[model samples]
Target: VGKIPWWKEAVFYQVYPASFKDTNNDGWGDIPGLIAKIDYLHDLGVDCVWLSPMFESPQKDMGYDISDYQAVYSRYGTLSDVDNLIAACHARGMKLILDLVVNHTSDQHPWFQESRSSKTNPKRDWYMWKPARYDADGNRMPPTNWRSYFAGPTWTWDELTQEYYLHLYDTSQPDLNWENEECRKAIYNEAMRFWLDRGVDGFRIDTVNKYSKRTDFPDAPVTMPGETDQPAAEMWCNGPRIHEFIREMNEQVLAPYNAVSVGELSNTPLPSQVLPYVSAAAKELDMVFEFSTIRLGTGGPFHGKYLYREFPLSELKAYVATWQQWLEGTDGWHTVFCENHDNGRAVSRFGDDSTVELWEASAKTIALWQATLTGTIFLYQGQEIGMVNMPKEWPIEQEYKDVESLNFYGEAKASGDAERIRKTEKGLKILARDHSRIPMQWDASPNAGFTSAGVMPWMRVHDGFKDLNVEKQEGDDESVLRFYKKILKMRKEYSGLFVHGAFRPVLQEDETLFVYVKDDQGSEESGVQVNKRRKALVAMNFSGQPASLQEHDLDVAATLGCKHGEELLLVTTLKKNDFSRMEAGVLKPWESRVYLNF
Candidate 1:
């Protein structure tokens, strides 16, 4: 209604290209494969496409370790193929954004290669390279006591120079030194500009807050139990110069192109701390993803992505409400998402994935939850069809492609602790990134319609693809994919209230139920007629049994502002969806509904 940007009202779909579809049957998805699915994405109500890393890489961190910034991976395609893909998206009024991972480069990248070469090369200062420290007449040590995000020490001893190189992740992925202005300029021109100039709309910047670090490189004081290295998040995450670097980027690259950027800010949790990055006046970022809620189940006391527990639904209210209320009328915007390429499926992690019968209902419930939230929607691959996580029975060696998963399992197995090994195995099977990276179930073909029959996919296809594939549910009126379409349609229909209205939490303390009210409460005050205001309510029962509506908190019948009894537009879990009245009543397990008054 106001002067909001196009992205504020658009929906984004993230495609893990390697697992989406393989047209050439190379055991990997390629640009031609993505081009074939363009109409499908447009039909799913997607306005933008967020492609995971398909750039030239060593695949050490699965494309995060970039060997060349301006080239596409040979296995995926050539530069001309990427150009064609971008044209296909634009033909359908869609925007395509690439993954910008400039925090580091592959150790084999030409820049890093020269940096590690004699230690006095022109690019020697391009990366965070430090000398090995001697332990006072004892053995040598790393420059700091920091742990690599993948597992080992942050410093890797390069045999060529006998000096150490700093890597926050795997040794193959070395960290970039943003302290050097020349390196920063080269990265901007080579990596970001190359794509943006080629008709690419923008970037989903990876680890946006990690560009700056504590110059001293102090030893991390935080350590989990039974660990040799510490998680040095404090020394690097959202450091003092974080905002400065972002502002400079906005000035140098983003502003001139008139492009949008949604940054990955995994470690910055608090709303106040993130305002600088997302504040519209600040011109830093359009929006950011914060992970205080997403990180609860994993990385608690553990050093890596070991599942410590389930994501608590009772605690969901406070987390969602805090962000919604904090940035309601400010210069900042919010990002609402539950699943991505880095995490487990939404239905498995947040909803019940216990039985085949519950999968559809639970997936619909979560879709309703995501739809009603007031922000841009981001759907990962296979989420529309309600794809659940990889079966827990799949063996690790077959499906575990993530480096973090393998590193944890390898070390646990070597210790000979049977209990530790058993728990870790089950956890990785349930929560590892492999669950999200599996081949997208397009149809009931031998390879889930992803690759050829006998040609094996890079990862094993989930067995449920036989019955749960897209073809099986395409015409079904009440399928999970259909539910998403209907809900998103409703949001667009009432964009006045859903997209630009105010957000309020109702019954914030309820454990098994999540209810929120979204309305244009201040429209009249802002010079509109009183009769034209709108209000809507969204409720979800995140449980397997019945849940009751609190009468005092929500007198749905008397004060819901509805013209009809309820004016129910959608009830996802109900088979018939015949509800017409708003009243205090019992809700069935996994039921979610939207009631509106316009």
Candidate 2:
């Protein structure tokens, strides 16, 4: 309710451009469409909109393989459209964050073109290029065992230069040599000036840590067989000079303005390694989003088997607490979210959806967890409506559209491994492009009211749109959208408790429920009392069957509010009045509940 710092306590809404809105009936979401929907974003109570890459590209990697860093992709819109959107967002007091893809550039980028033109070209050294090694028999080989994140060897041969260039991702995306001062300066200058000149708030840097690679380009210790194409852990990923480069870039570009910079850092360990990237002194990143939570069910190269991984409530709490402890101890900030453009919908990944009541509860429970955390929270499009991952029944071909997914499928087929084929199918089907890139189901009308005319959407909308569209949910007070609005309003109102409060776990022994309480510095007693009074207990019954709460040591159920007396603040499971009754309650699979003990 009081004045709040924009960076510390703002909710961000990530808009996947192609799926957001189709203004020109081009079947792809565009910036103008987003501009028209700024009010929709504002009404949702989101303080920021993180638009996925809109820079010019061939769309091979969905604008991530950027050809032009400064120009808007024609598929999305023109430069004026972005300026208009920025103006609209600023006018409404909502900040706009652009995706900064500086780790690599599209093969079509002029710099890359120049790099591959000739060995002595001025831009040749701007990218990581090394001569390929050959055996006595003239057998060609890559410089290292490094693998591309997409799949296969990280180094791709260039005939003109007679060398191999490093591409941590798709071959079409060549890694820029950040070690080259000139190259690093150019990237920093271009990325910083582009958005800053447009009055944009900041950048959600894509793979900031990947910018710096070891000068040796060593191979990573093989973690998974056949997953060799990924950047050798030693070759890239938190390279030696990452911290220095980030700090320099921050000093020169990010630190000048009061901007909010969040880094998209993935695959790093906790405590020692990941903490430094977000510390205040680093001045490089205002916040960092670690993807461990999103990568739970995934195995191998992320396209591996889902494995039906079960994340016990205790483990989830520990993961949250570790970051909480780190953030509290250091001068660092964290970004939190379960779903993103690259991740499958959270409800389907972490919860069950056999029934409507259960689905809504699961969604609300996840929202409660995300909102209560001490970090900048992100709510991807359609998450507000309790959208789940795409069902396996959708056309497999349509769903398996991403280059990575297609490549894995082809590899599995070629290997003649039936088991691998099945796993690949299930993995791709379960967490496919279709899951995250589905059309925005605005209403129940034709095409879910996304567009007026009869036209094929870039991807299929969930069939549940008839009953799950925005029009229907917007009016229902208990709908996911309304619930999220309530949660956001609550977060804004209790920003003190949620933002600066010391996070402590409650019901530490319970594996089925995740409960935590945050106590403001001076308001520890008041906060405990408030939580207890408000029935502030946050619980999620992880078990398919209901779980009975058990009274534990003082440390177990850390009381934040009035002492627990006759009734518990909240009980996610449908059990007896007393949780200690030893009787199992019905959770109906992945259901969550929050009670106010006041």
Candidate 3:
């Protein structure tokens, strides 16, 4: 077949800078610390590194609230440090992508400062400001019924000017007005060009879909009853002019440098709703990160993301299949990820983390599934080392650092009830973002070898770090770290079958098995006929008990037009077993195997 784009075949490793490594011994990770680990990343087989926001900010929301577009955060380092890191990455044949957070800037930003000075200021139109609405009883009310993602009303009343500013996140982060032409131009020329000229690769645009808002500023229709009502995201997310704004960004900045752009799309209801944002013909983003599959186990809409419940295997399969089928022939691409800075660890959330053996097997199973998919795979920091969630026994006040979780705790505490507090604690244990923000486990030493023992980390290291650390697993052939390296290497070796092939589900009805095949057969571009094509089968057992499957049950010959062979490319079983027994339909608990069929 034909060669694909670099992004299409590349594997991206996401680094949450604060938790990655610390070089200054200040208990916080810096750019120099990340540069020191370039060799570690290179050996891991990732082609690109996507760093979270390190831009100058007050860090109210942990760098999401940007105060300066061109400067670096003091805790991270200086511009020269960023330049050195970029050079280091390129020298090692790896690309670097920075986080672009233009949706809103910190309230301390000069632009916001000038805009709020007076109603007639030149920059007044840059941000959304409106007069409050007063009821007949003479009580002042927000202009609309919208609510922020963090908590409270979306509009924050500024007493100085007697006007309310719209902030979809924290009140300190005021949303920018994209309806203004000059604002869009400034972002493309100043903010975007500054990074592109620095020789950095691309950007992972934050809140890319929420760039536009309804001009009318109408009240959002309530979907469910709740104490803390949230604004209907449909009223704002993927707004009317979102496409036009992204296209302008692409045509003016990203396209000129041949850079990759991936949008973070939240509240996207379906695959079709996301197609336009990333479609090549639309001249928008190169890809997008959708959360439909990630939200499967959460309590639907009414309850917040912190509330978790059981999810069925069948439902998970169907959710993933929808995206796979919708984007098959489209120019748009998808991003495959299981963990990030804003979510819980994958092994703890989706896999069985009850025992060490189960954790290792389940983690490898997840890695195998993500690697064989037909899109870019994102590996979060510490994911390669099989990191799990924080201990459930820790109290929120002592362990949690995220604003969202802390705010929720405060709101629940106001109830003055013990049961409510207990429930909130349980929910936080299951789904708080802090679970993934722990320091990366490098060694068995104090502080997980992330920082010096004299300095305390920004967040507590997971208690299990002593047993599940990089130093202990790096040399072990049976370690999850080695399994990740092997799967990544296999993707490079069999790029034709795993990277460019079409995915078809197998044994979809099975309760304990999630099986699929990636086969490149009967393609017009292939010189061989339909009967002589390459295929690979990926079968995974999601349960804790042994499962069996017969040759007739898999129907390998009927699906691929060839009998299954005896080649086992990868297996995630800890038991000492013979390979020939696989054909006899004996699969150990949590075992996953990938077979190459010829």
Best prediction by lDDT: 3
lDDT of 2 by residue, 1-598 (tens): 2333577778899999988888887678889989988998899998899999999998888898999888889979998998899899989999999999999999999999998999889889999999888869999988887766676788899887789998888899998988888888788678677678788899899988788788876656766676544436546778888999988888888888767788988878566787788877767788888876777667744445332455666766777777766666566667779888886788887766767767776787787778777777888999988888777777566555677777767777877989878777777766655588888888888778666568777777678889887889888776788878877887767655665566777777677667666655512322222342132445566556654444433222335355444334333423233356433233335555544434
Q: What is the lDDT, from 0 to 100, of the residue 481 in candidate 2?
A: 84
| TM-score of each model, paired residue for residue | 0.95, 0.91, 0.95
Ranking by lDDT: 3, 1, 2
1-598, model 1: which lDDT tens digit per residue? 3455888879999999889999888899988899999998899899999999998999988899999999999878999999999999999999999999999999989999899888789888888878887787888889998877777788899999878888888889999999899999998999988888999999999999998999888888855656668888778889879898989998999989988899999767788888888988999999888876556567452354674575567577788888767775577876778888877787887788898667777899888888777767788989999998888888897668999788878878887989878878877766777889999999998999999999989888889898888888887888888878887887777665666567778777777788888787633222223456677778778888777765425555434566546555444467665355333366677877777764
CA shift at 558, candidate 3, in angstroms?
A: 5.0
Candidate 3: lDDT over CA atoms? Answer: 0.82
2 or 3, which is superior by TM-score?
Answer: 3
**Residue lDDT tens for model 3, 1-598:** 4445688778899998999999888889989999999999999998899999999899889899999999999889999999999999999999999999998999998989999999999999999999999989999988887867786788999898899999988999999999999988888876788999999899999999998998788877775456435556776799999888998899989999999888899888688899999777899998899887777666653335556677878777776667665677777777888888887888887788999889988988888888877667889999998898899988899989998888778777886878767777887887788988999999999999899887899988888888999999997887899889988988776665666567788877677888888876423232223444677778788888877756327654445555555444554544344455554465677888777754
Measured by TM-score, how close is model 1 to the native structure?
0.95
Deviation in Å, model 1, residue 166 alpha carbon: 1.2
Displacement of residue 406 (Cα, Å) in model 1 is 0.5
Q: Residue 241's C-alpha lDDT in candidate 3?
A: 95
